[model samples]
Each structure stands twice: as structure tokens, then as C-alpha cells.
Target chain A: MDLNIAVLAGDGIGPEVTQQAIKTLNAIGEVYNHNFTFKDAVVGAAAIDQTGDPLPEKTLKVCLETDAVLFGAIGDPKYDNDPSAKVRPEQGLLKLRKSLGLFTNIRPIKAYPTLIDKSPLKEDRINGTDLTIYRELTGGIYFGEKKLNEEGTVASDLCEYSDFEIERIAHLAFKAARARKKKLTLVDKANVLETSRLWRKVVTKIGESYPDITLDFLFVDNAAMQMILNPNQFDVILTENMFGDIISDEGSVIGGSIGLLASASVGEDHSMFEPIHGSFPQAKGKDIANPIASILSAAMLLEHFKLYEEAKAIHNAVEKALELKVVTTDLDPSSKYTTTKVGDFIADYIANSE
Target chain B: MDLNIAVLAGDGIGPEVTQQAIKTLNAIGEVYNHNFTFKDAVVGAAAIDQTGDPLPEKTLKVCLETDAVLFGAIGDPKYDNDPSAKVRPEQGLLKLRKSLGLFTNIRPIKAYPTLIDKSPLKEDRINGTDLTIYRELTGGIYFGEKKLNEEGTVASDLCEYSDFEIERIAHLAFKAARARKKKLTLVDKANVLETSRLWRKVVTKIGESYPDITLDFLFVDNAAMQMILNPNQFDVILTENMFGDIISDEGSVIGGSIGLLASASVGEDHSMFEPIHGSFPQAKGKDIANPIASILSAAMLLEHFKLYEEAKAIHNAVEKALELKVVTTDLDPSSKYTTTKVGDFIADYIANSE
Candidate 1:
């Protein structure tokens, strides 16, 4: 098999961590006897510095023409601190998502046994907890039409959803549920919001086709509470943009470390995999940022292409790293592992494993 | 001193728990030598069954005529299980809030020493957690204009905020912070939403007037995560309606049990106190429901009227009940204490304590 990948290692520790993911992917390609080609592209602050545009035309072209996009982190304090700045690094990724038609975001939250004690939740509560959030990324409040009155005293944002928008994400969530635990929980404020009622109606209609999968609904507030109280009860959790943003971020902490969470944003024709963590500006050249999130994102990319065995190999390597305590300072302050060293260990394990 | 209290024990366990609260209030009145009068009214499913209206005009009249209101839980499984019901038990509370102009919803979350172990979070994460959330109750998306397109396929809800709405709540939250830890964390999605930016601007301006209080900002997503990761880091949390609903509910569980959470909704001219937990229909007549939340709500009512000494007495008595392990089944299933027994103990403690 042949794979073409577009790499956008944006800023700060992004380049350092993304290099590790690429190294691990190369190892997988070697062991599996596959051809993997990579094309480099500038994005975010780095692109802004070079071309005065965060998502340069050539960069987007590379992403569009590739099999999948392997994205690192974006954002920079230079842009973040200047709130009045006309152009920002975040707008680049938002534009890319719109250009590439990336609509649905998938976030998988799992509590690894070795790290259960590190979670804020009790071991009994967090143990064996595995849930994936299917968040509708493009079509909710975030992208809604916003208004501010001439007096600047009143501001408003519209949260709108059409049946088409709900159908696309619902189908993907149902398919994911069918492949997993055969259960799906739709999080919404159906009793309050008209858009939520539409979401429930559309998701319910879609659920009928997948008769084997169980469908349930929870109000967003109740879902937020339930996420902490009993995380193990969920399988594939689906929600719209704003609710998803809050709940998925809430779910991210249950896994013990933000450094280990990865996410994927997909559309009909394209998908992008990236670590959920931001570019740690303070850890830019420190060789200390955790690489596991980036590496696992590569694993998700493999899974997207139906390379199950290859994905599993990366997963096993990651599990071995956790078991051996070969982690960066974030996971283990006493360990003598650099970002590159952790990547090397995982890549070696992938190549040498039975 | 004279106090006229309106009691609207809506449905299910509402009446039972409210009885406990009324008993405790009576004990406070006797100890403090204050003249207390009680008026009864119906709301929610009970009101619907009796008067065919959730919030009967007679009930609103009773509430408006009183100094303050003591609200028990609302909602019934019958109304909840029916999707097509035109009048829901929840609408009663919504109508009441709107009619009373209850713009600010205040929920205090504290991790009691005795019940800390009951929390799903680890002891270290949840212990010593004390925070208050001032949620804007009457505005934002919940009350925003909603629309469904002619095709019945598109739906939208507008999230709008005005300077007046933000200012009123900001002053209350700032006053709250001044009375406590002198720190105010305003949660909003300012980077994305126009309304949030308005919130940040308004809060920032108001925060300048509170020079002693350290004011900060957090996106709603980050606020949701921080509520669980490090709850003690917060002093006063101010947010819009929806974010408050989610985070307050999330914060409710950190105190070990929702059975111990109390909330107060206040406007300029009116206020209502209630337990955060819903009416448990299963325990309606079983005498097993927890009354601590309702009793604490009564304490809050006293505090609202500037009856600090009387409120402290109720708090001390409730704490004594928890200390003595005279809790309901939710906190301790094997406990032999019934709802009335726990209420009796609290009232007795208030009356007998020197």
C-alpha cells in the first residue's frame, strides 16, 4: 500500500513532537512493507512568519491533494497576547477546516491501566473507561452569524442546525457505535433548544437503520455531570458544537493527561489527525514536551485508512512505553527521557516487535 | 423581625423535603425570636393536576406577596416520559423565574469533611473544595428567540446579551467575591462569540471598580475542565445561563452528593431558594429522600435576609447531623434514619444549642 501525507508542524513544541510521529510512522511503513511519502507545509505562526498568511495557498493545496493530513499544534503567544491583531493563528486552522470541508471531530477518551492512579477520579471510577466523542464541529454556534448592535451594548450569536448537518454527523456516530459497543448517547438540550430538538429528531431517524445499536439521549447539563459521575457507561457520545466543546474538554481530563489525548476531524473527502494539546510555547526547544499524543494521532490516521494491524502495533508500542515508564517529564518527572528518546523507543518497539 | 415565606412544594419528594425545611425554619424563628408566617401554593405537575397550569396565577401572587420563597423540587416521571406533553413540570420553574425576575442563580458548592468520601473524584482532588457559581438565569440562549424554518428541517436559537443584563449579574458576583475570597473568574467563550466578548468587556469594566478582587477569564470549555481538575482554585464563578447550568451541575457532584446542594435565584426585588436536586418521584412517599439540601436552602434564605446568626445556627445544626451520621439512604444506604428523623434532629439541634 502507498500513503501520501501532508505534515503541518505549526509552532513551539509542535515541530519537536510532530517529528516523533513521523519517525514512528516511518518505522510502521518499514515493518509493514508499505510506501509512505510525506510533504511538508507551513501553517499557523510559522506560516505567518514566512508568507504573511497562516494557511498559505500552497499549504492548503498540499493538504487537499494528500491521503490525509498529519497536523501538529497551532497558536502562539505573540498572536494570543495581541487581542486587537487583525489576523490570528487560530483563524488559519479554522479556514483550513472550512476549505477542506472537515465537519466532524472524533475524540477518544481512554483510561490506561498504568495511568489510572494519575486521574483526578478514583481508580474504581476511571478504570476500564473508554468513550469516544463525535462532535459536530463546523455547523453550530461557533460558525453562526454573530451581531453587535451599533451601540455595541448588545451582542448575539445564532446557533442553527439543519437536518442535513445533523444527518451527516449522526450517520458517522452511528457507524462508529456499530463498530464499537453498539450504543450511542446523543447529548443535547432537546427540552429547551429548537436546534437540539432537530438534532434528536434527525439522530432518532438515523438510529432506526442501525437497529442493533442502542440509542439514548441526555440533556447537555446532565451529560456534563454524568461524564464525571459514571464515565464508564458511555460508548459513542455525539453532540453539536458548543455542547461538544464543553463535554469533550471535560472528558479529556478523565484520561489523566491532556498530553495523551488525540483527535481527528473528518469530512467526506478529507480527514486531519492531531494532538488535542496546544503548542507549549515554554517548551519550544526544551526537548521535554510529550510526544505520545502526536504519535497516537498517527495511529488514528492509520486506523482511518483501515490499517488495523499497523494501528494496533503503534498502540502496543505506546502501551509498552507506559508500562516501562519511558515517558517525558510531563508523565514522569524523574524519568530521563527526552521527546526524541520516547519517540525512538516507540519506533524501535514497532519495528522489533513480534 | 417579621418574615412572610411562600412555600411551593411542587411534586414528588418536593412536599416531604420541603416539610423538613419548614420545620427547620420554624426552629430558627423560635430561637431567634422572629415572627415567621408561611403561605402555601402549588406549582409544577402537582399544580397542573390541580389547576391545569404549572405556575398558577394564585401561586405567583402568593410568591410576590411574600418576603421570600422556599421552592422544593419539581417535575414528575409522567411529564418526563411523555414527549408530546404541551405543559411540562419544568415550565413551572421557568415561568416562576421569569415572573419573579430571578436573573442571578447562585449555587454554593462545598466539600463537607464528613461526606467528602462519597464523591466520585479522589479525596485529594475534591477535598477542601469550596466555590460559588453566579449564573445569569433569565437571559442568553434559553430565553433567546428560537426559529424553525418552513421546511421543519432547520432550527436556530439566538444567544443574546445586553450591557444591563451583564452589569446586574456582574455587580452581584463582584459583591459575592468581595464577601469571600476576593477572586472572580468570569467564564465565557470570548474568542469565538460576540456575546462572550461583551461579557468579558463588561466584566472587565466592573472588575476595575472592584480593585481588591482579582478578576480573570476562562473559556467555557476550560472552565468545565477546571471545575473538576482543581475546584479549589475558584472563588466566585460568573457565567451566562447555559455555561452556568452545565458547570454548576458539574460542580454539584464534587461536594459528594447532589442531595446536599442548595441554590438561590435572586433578582433586584425578589428571590427564591431551592435545592439543586430534582424531585425524586420514586421516593415521593417512601420517606427515604435526603433533606439536607432543602434544610440548607432554608439557611441560605436566612442569610439572604441578613440573618447571619440564624443562618449559622441552621448550618451548625445541619453539620451536626452529618457529623452524627444521621443521613438519608443516598449518602448511606444502611443508615436507619428517615427523612423526618433527620429533619427532627436538625431542628432539635438548632433549638437546644447554646
Candidate 2:
């Protein structure tokens, strides 16, 4: 098997985590008789500083050429504090997503029994909680037309979504649901927004194709509430871009640390995998950032290719590390392991166990 | 002082719980030297059944003339399940909010130490949890224009917000923060949505007026996740309409039963007080409804009038009933009190003690 991978080691701790994921991937390659080629690309603030474009033409070209892209973190405090700055790091990420045609963001939230104590929810409420989120990445308010008033006192952002956008993502969610728990919970504000109504109508109809998948609808507001109250009741939660953005963040809490969560954004020709956690600018050089999420993202990449055994190996490596208390400070505050050490431990575990 | 309170007992446990609130309100009237008038108004499914209107014109007239409106619950399974039904019950509530100019929906989530075990969250998480949500009712997507495709293949809803809408609601949130812990967190999807950017721009400006209050912003998604991870970090959360709907519902989990929380929808002209819990259509006419939330709504009504003593009296009565183990089945199965019986206990406690 030959794999072409685009590596975007974004700003802050992104490079640090990406290095660990690369090490894990290399170990997987050694164990499995696979040939792999990698291309490094600049993105976010780094790309902006170098090419004056967060997502340079070369970076997009590299991403397009690769089968899957492994992304590190992005964003910098320099851009975050300077709200007046026109070219921000986040713009690069949004642009990269649009350019790559990565429209569906799949975030899996599962509570690990070993880390249940870390969660604020009760054991009963959080235990046995496993759910996936299908977030429409490229549409809704994210891509909507924005306006600022002449007086500057008022600003408006149009949250417009065509039926076409909603249906495409709805189809993905239903398809995923049909394969998994056979339940799809559509989260939208149908009572208020035209887009949500379109979302409900389109998704409700699409759901009919997968008869085994029970369809239910929740107003985005109510869905947020339900996420906390009874997260276990959900199997697959399908939502639009904006709603997905918030709910996905909220869903990550079930796993104890958002740092431990990984997400995948897949389109027709390309796929991108990354940790859901943001670049902690403070942890850029500290060597304390968690690398498990990035490593797990590599696992997801393998799973996407139907490499279930390879994917399970990576997941098991993480689960094993947690079980043995050989984790970064985020998981084991008393441990002396650094980011590099945690990554090394997981890779060694994978290699040795194999 | 005399208060003519119009009671809108919509459907399900609406009549049952409103009966409790009324009894509690009337009991306070005797001790506070306030004459009280309780006029019953039909709304929701009950009204749709009787007058072919969820909120009849006569009912709106009564509400217009009242000092305050205390509502129970609304909606029924029949109306809830059949989404195609033309004269839905929730329409009346939405119309009532728009007509009454009820822009602010205030929900207070406080964990009762005695009932911590009953909460879905861990005891430690719930013990000191106290959150208040000021949800904007008449703006954003819920009220936005909805469109359906010609072929029924697509559905869409527009989510728009004006400068005025954002400003007024932000001011209310800031004011509430000032009275609480001097911290305000604004939740929005500024990373993607233009409406969110408008929200941040306005709220950030409004924040300047209150230098004493520490204002912060979070994407709605992250806010949802954080609400579960470390709810103790928040003081006051201000967000747009759709975000509020979800956050408030998730927030209610801190208090255990949804039936234990009350909400106040306030405007310049009139205000409506009701339980935050939705109408449990299945519980209608069952006498098994928990009236605590409705009773607490009565407490909120008194507080709105700045009748601190009157409000305290009702709150104390409620506390004593809980202390004595005289509560509805939802609270404690040992007592097994009916909705009216629990209401009577609180009313009796207030009348006897005061």
C-alpha cells in the first residue's frame, strides 16, 4: 500500500503534536508493510507570515495531491488579541477547509471509563456515553455574507443556507447512522430560521431511506440542553455549520478533555484529520501538550481506508497508555512525562505489542 | 397593594401546576395586605381544543389587563407528535412572547444542596452550582423567516439579528452580571457567523460601559462543552436567541428535575412567569405533576415587583416543605404528594408561619 500524506504543522503546539502523530504513523508503517510519502505544508499564522496567505496556493496544492492531510493546531495570541488585524490565522483555516472541499466534520465523543472521574457529570449520566457529531463544515453562517454598518456601531452577518447544503450533510449523517446505531437526531432551529426548516424538511425526508434508523428532531437550543442532560440517548447528532460548531465543542466534554478528541473533515476527493483541541499558544515550546488526540486522528485516517486493525492498534495504544497511567500531565498531573515522552510511550506500546 | 394576576394554564400539567402557583400567590396576598385576583385564561392545546385558538383574543385581553401573568405548562403529545397540525399550541406561546414584548427570558439554575443526589450531575458538581440564563426571546432564528422548497426536498430558516435586538439583550445581561458576580460570558459563533460577529461587536462595546464587570466571549459550541466540564467558572452567560434556548435547558440539569426550575419572560409593559419545564403532555390530568417550578414562578413574580419580603415568604415556605419531606413524587417517592398537595403544603406553610 502506498500513502501520500500532507502534513500541516500549524502554529503553537501544533508542530509538537504533529511530530508525535508522525512518529506514531511511522511506527504503524513499519509494522504493516506499507510505503508512505509525506509533504510538509505551512498554514495559519506561519503561512500568513511567510506567503501573506494563511492557506497558500502551494499548501492547497499539496493537500489536493495527498490522500489525507494530518493537521496540527492553528491560531496565535498575536492575531487573537489584535482583533483589528485583517489577516488572521483563523481565516486561513476556514479558507483551507473551503479550498479542500471538506464539508462534513465528523466528531466522535466517547467517555472512557478510566477517565470518568475527570468529568463533572455524574457517573450514571456520563458512563456508557458514546456519540458522533456530523457538522456541516462549509456552509451556514460561516460562509454567509457579512456586513458592517457605515456608522460602525452596528455589524451584521447573514446566516443563509440553501437547501442543497443541508441535504448533502444530512445524507452523510443518515448514511453513518444506518451503519451504526440506526438513530439520527437532527439539531436545528426550525421554528425560527428558514435554513433550519429546510434542514428539518430535507433531513426528515432523507431519513426515510434508512428505515431502521429512527429519526428525531431537536431545536438546536433543546439539543444543547439534551447533550448535557441525557447524552446517552443520542447516537448520531446531525446539525448545520453554526449549530455543529457549538454542539461539537460541548460534546467533547464527555471525554474529559477536549484535548483528547479528534475530528475528521472529509469531502469527495480529500480528507483532513486533526485534534479538536485548539493550539495552546502557551504550550508551544513547553513540551507538555497532549499528543493523543493527534495520534488518534492518524488512527481515524487508517479507519477511513478500512484499515480497522491499524486503527484499533492506535486506539488501543492510547487506551493502554491511559490504563497504565503513562500519560502526559493533562491525564496524569503527578506524572513526570512530557509531550515527547507520552508520544514515545504510545509509539513504543504500539510497536512492542504488535 | 393589590395584584390581579392572569393565569394562563395552557395544557398538560398547566392547570395542575398553575393551580398550585395561584394557591401560593393567593396565600401570600392575605399576609402582604395585597388583594389578589386570579383570572383563568386558556392557551396552548387546551385553548386550541375549546376556542380553536391556542391563545384566544379573550385570553390575551385578560393578560393585557393583568399586573403579571403566571403560566403553568403548554403543549400536548397530540400536538407535539403531529408537526403538520396547522393550529399548533407552541404558536400561541411564541405569539404571546412577541405580543407581550417579552424580550428577556430569565432562567435561574441553582442546585439545592438537599437534592444534589437527584441531579444528573455529580454531587460535587451540583452542590455549589448557581447559574442564571437571560435568553432573548423575540429575536434570532426562531422568529426568522422560514421557507420550504417547491418540491418539499429542501427547508431553510433565516437567522437574522438587528443592532437593537443585540444591544437591549446585552444590556440586560450586563446588568444582571453586575448584580451577581461581576463576570459576564457572551456565547456566540463569531468564528463563522456574521450574526455572531455583530453580537460580539455590540456586546464588546456594551462591555465598555460596565468597566467593573469582566466580560468574555466564547463560541457557542465551546460554551456548551464548558457548561459541563467546569460550570463553576461561569457567573452570567449572555448569548443570542438560539444559543440561549440550548444553554438554558442544559443549565437546568444543575437543579435536578426540570420541574424544579421557573422562568420569567419580561418586557417593558408586561411580564410572564412560568416553569422552565415543558408541558409534560403525558402527565396532563394525572395529578402527578410537580408544582415546585410553578410555585417558584410565583416567587419570581413577587420579586419582580420588588416585594422582597413577599418573595422571601414564598421561598421560605417552599424550603420548609422540602425540609419536612413534603414534596411531589419527583422530589421524593417517600412523600408521594400530588401536585396540589405539594402546593397546599407550601401554601399552608406560608399562611401558618406568616
Candidate 3:
């Protein structure tokens, strides 16, 4: 099989960490005897500095022509602190998502056995906790019509959801639940918001088709508490955009380190995989940033194309690295392993391991 | 001082737990040489069962005539499970808030040294966690205009905020911060929502007036993650209705059992105190429900009336109860203490302790 991938190594530590992902992917390509080609494009603050546009036409073109896009972290302190700047680095990624029509964001939160001690939660609370969140990305309050009164005294944002929007994500979430624990919990404020009631109505109708998968409902506030009190009880969580953004970030902490979590944003036609963490501007060119999330993102890219064995191989390598303590400073402060060294270890293990 | 109090012990374990709070308040009255009068009113499912209205006119009249309302719990499985039911038990509380014009909901989350083991988080993470959340209750999406298309294909809820709405709550929160740690963190989605940006602008202006208080900002998503990763960093968290609803509930878990948390809803002219936990239908009449939260609500009621010394005595007595293992089954499963027993112990200690 031949795969063409687009690499958007954005800014700060993004380039450094993304290099490790490319190295590990190359290792997988070698081991699986798959032909792979990659094209690099600038984005985020780096693109703004060079082309005066965060998401350049060339970058979008490259992403469109590829089998999948491998995204690194984006953002820089310079752009983040500037309130006056109109074209921000984050808009680049948002535009890319809109262009690609990526409406569903998949985040898998797992408490690894070896990393339990690293978590803020007690061992028993987070033990054996593995859940994936299917977040509807393009709709909801964030993209709704915003209004500010002429007096500057009042401001509003409309949170809107259509049946078509809810149905598309519900099918994906139900399918993912069918493949995993056969359970899905839809988190919404059905008692208060009309949109949430619609979510329940449409999702319940979708649940009828997948009779084998059990469906449950939890209010968003209760869902937030349950994420901390009993994370293990959840299998697959489905929610609208804002609730997803909040809980997914909350769930990222349950895994002990944000540096180890990866996410995938996919639509009907295009897909993009990226790390959950942002570009650590302070760690730029320091070779001390964690590369595992980026490497795992490459694994997700493989899985998007139905390369199960290749993806499993990458997962096995990651587990081995964790077991051997081949991690960056975030996981083990005393360890001297650099960012590239950790990536090299994982790549080497993938190539040689039986 | 003479005080007239309204008690609305609505449903399930509400009556039993509220009885303990009354007993404790009576003890405080005896020790402080104060005249106290109590009026009983019905709300929630109990009110619905009797008058077919959750918050009857008589109950609102009783509340209006009282110094403050001491609420227990609301909700029942009957109204909760029946989606077709036009009236809900929760509506009683919402209506009461609107009638009383209670715009600010205050919840203080603290990790007791003795009960640290009950928390899901590691000991070090929650050891000294003490934070108060001032939530703007009467506004935001919950009260916003909701719309559903004629075809039932689309649903939307508008989240609107005015400077006046933001200012009233901001002043209360800033005052609370000044009394506590003199640090305030305003949580909002300023990067996205127009309402949030308005919040930032208004709060930033209000913050300048209180120059002694160190004010900061965090996006709602990152704030959710930070609540778990580093809870101790927060002093006073001020947010809008929905963000507060999510984070305050999330913050509740850090102190171990939700049974130990109390909250206060205050307006300019009226105030109400209640336990943050819901009515547990399973624990109704079982004599096993924890009464500490209700008792603490009574303490907050005392504080609202400027009876700090009386409030301190109650706090000391409750702390002693936890220290002596006189807690109910929720805190200690094998202690063999009933709800009334724990309440009796707290009341006795408050009355007799020097």
C-alpha cells in the first residue's frame, strides 16, 4: 500500500516533536513493507511570519492531496499575548478543520498501568480507566452567531444544533461504542437546554438501530464530577462541542500527563491526527519536549486507514518505552533522555522487536 | 438577636437531614442567647404532590416573611424519570431563585485533614485544597431564549450576559476574595464567546477597583483541567452560571464525599442555604444519610447574619465529630452511626463545648 501524508509542523516545539513521529512512522513503513511519502508545509505562527497567513494556500493544498494530515502543536507566546493582532495562530488550525470539514474529534483517555503513580488521582480511582470521547467539533456555541449590543453592555452567543449535525456524530459514536465496550453515555443538559433535548431525541433514535449497544445519559455537570470520582465507569462519552472541549481537557489530566495523549479529527473525507498538548514555546529547540503524543498521533493516522497491525505495533512500542522508562523530563524529572532519544528508542524497538 | 427562619425540607431524605440542621441551629440559639423562630414550608416534589405546583404561592410568602431560608434537598425519581411530566421538582428551586432574585451562588470546597483519605485524588494533591466558587446563577444559557424550529430539526439556546449582571456578581466575588486569600481567578471562554469577552472586559474593569486583590484569567476548558491537576492554586473562582455549574461540581469531588459540601444562594435582599448534594431517594427514611452538609448550611446561615462566633463554634464541633469518627456511613461505612446520631453529636458538642 502507498500513503501520502501532509506534515504541518507548526511552531515552538511542534517541529521537534513532529520529527520524532516521522521517524517512527518510517520505521513502521519499513517493518510493514508499505510505501510512504511525506510533504512538509508551514502553519501557525511560523507561517504567519513567513507567508503572512497562518494557513497558507500551499499548506491547505498539501493537506487536501494527502491520504492523511499529521499535525504537530500550534501557538506561540508572541501571538498568544497580542490582543491587538487580527490573524492569530489558532485560526490557522480552525480554518484547516473548516476546509477539511472535520466535524468529529476523537480523544481516547486511558490510565496506563505503569503510569498510575504519575496521576493526581488515587490508584484505585483511575485504575483500568480507558474511555474515548467523540466530540462534535464544528457546531455549537463556539461557531454560533455572536451578538453585542450597540451600547457594549450586552453580549450573546447562540448555541445551535441541527438533527443532521447530531445524527452524523451519533452514528460515529455508536459505531465506536459497538467496536469497544458496547456502552455509550451521552452527556448533555437535557433538562434545561432545548439543544440538549434534541441531542437526546436524535441520539435515542440512533440508539434504536444499534440495539446491542447500551445508551445512558448524564448531565454535563454530573458528567464533570463523574470524570474525577469514577472515570472507569465510562466507556464512550458523546457530547456537543463546548462540553466536549471542557471534559476532554479535564480527561486529559486523568492519564497523568498531557504529553502522552493524542487526538484525531476526521470528517467523511479528510482526517487529521495531532497531540492534545500545545506547542510549549519555552521548550522550543531545547530537545526536552515529550514526543510520545506526536508519535501516537502517527499511530492514529495509520489506524484511520485500517492499518490495525501497524497501529498495534506502534502501541506495543509505546508501552515498551514506558516500561523501560525511555521518557522525557515530564514523566521522570531525573531521567536524562532527550526528545529525539525517546523517539529513537521507540523507532528502534518497532524495527527490531519480535 | 431574634431570627425568623423558613425550612423547606422537600423530598426523600430532605426531611430527615433538615431535622438535624434544625437541631444544630437550636443548639446554637441556646448557647448564643438568641430567640429563633422556625416556619415549615413545602417545595419540590412534596409541594407538587400536594398543590400540583413545585413552588406554591404560600411557600414563597413564607420565604419572603423570613430572615433566611434553610433548604434541605429536592427532586424525586417519580418526576425525574417521567419526561412527560410538565412540572419538575428542580423548577421549584429555579422559581424560588428568580422570585428571591438570588443571583449569586456561593460554594466553598475544602479538604478536611481528617477526611483526606475519602477523596479520589492523591493526598498531596488535595491536602490543603480550599477554594470558594461564586457562580452567577440567575443568568446565562439556562435562562437564555431557547428556540426549536417548527419542523423540530434545529434547536438553539442563546447565552446572553449584560454588564449589570456581571457587575453585581463580580462585586460579591471580589469582596469574598478580599476576605479570604485576596486572589481572584475569573474563569470564562474569553477567547471564543462574545459573552465571555464581555465578561473579561467588565471583570477587568471591576478588578481595577480592587487593586489589592490579584486578579487573573483562565479559559473554561483549561480551568476544568486545572481544577484537578492543581486545585490548591485557586483561591476564589468567579464564573458565569454554566461554567460555575460544571467546575463547582467538579471541585466538590476534591473534598471526598459530596455529602459534606454546603452552598449559599444570596441576593441583595434575600438569602438561602442548602446542601450541595441532591435528594437521595434510596436513602430516604433509611437513617443512613449524612447530615453534615445540612448542618454546615446552618452554619453558613449564621455567618450570613454576622454571627461569626456562633458559626465558628458549629465549625469546631463538626470538625471534632469528624476527628472522633462520629460520622455517618458515607464517611465511615463500618462506624454504625445513624444520621440522627451524628447530628446529635454535633449539636451536643456545639452546646456544651467551651
- Can you write out model 1's per-residue Cα lDDT over A242-330, one digit (the tens) per residue? 89999999999988999999999999999999999999999998999999999999999998898989999999999999999999988
Candidate 3 or 2, higher TM-score: 3
Candidate 1: regions farther than 4 A off: none
User: What is the descending TM-score order?
Assistant: 1, 3, 2
Worst 10-residue stretch by lDDT in candidate 2 chain B? Answer: B151-160
The parts of candidate 3 lying over 4 Å away from their true place are: none
Candidate 1 per-residue lDDT, tens place, B199-294, comes to 999999999999999999999999989988999899999999999999998898877788999999999989999998889898898899999999
Q: Can you tell me the CAPRI class of model 2?
A: medium
How much of the true contact map at the interface does candidate 3 reproduce, as a fraction?
A: 0.96
Candidate 2, after superposition: displacement of residue A145 in Å? 2.2
Best-fitting candidate, measured by lDDT?
A: 3
TM-score of 3: 0.98
C-alpha lDDT values of all predictions: 0.94, 0.84, 0.95
DockQ of each: 0.92, 0.61, 0.94
- Chain A only: TM-score per candidate: 0.98, 0.94, 0.98
DockQ of 3: 0.94
Give lDDT tens digits, candidate 2, residues A1-354.
789999999999999998999999888888987777789999999998999888999999999988999999899988889968898888888888888899999999989888998887788888899899999988776666666667654455556666678777888888878767889999887666777777777787777787889999998777777777778999999998878887887788766777789999988778999998888999898999999899989988998787879888999999988898878888878988888988999889889996
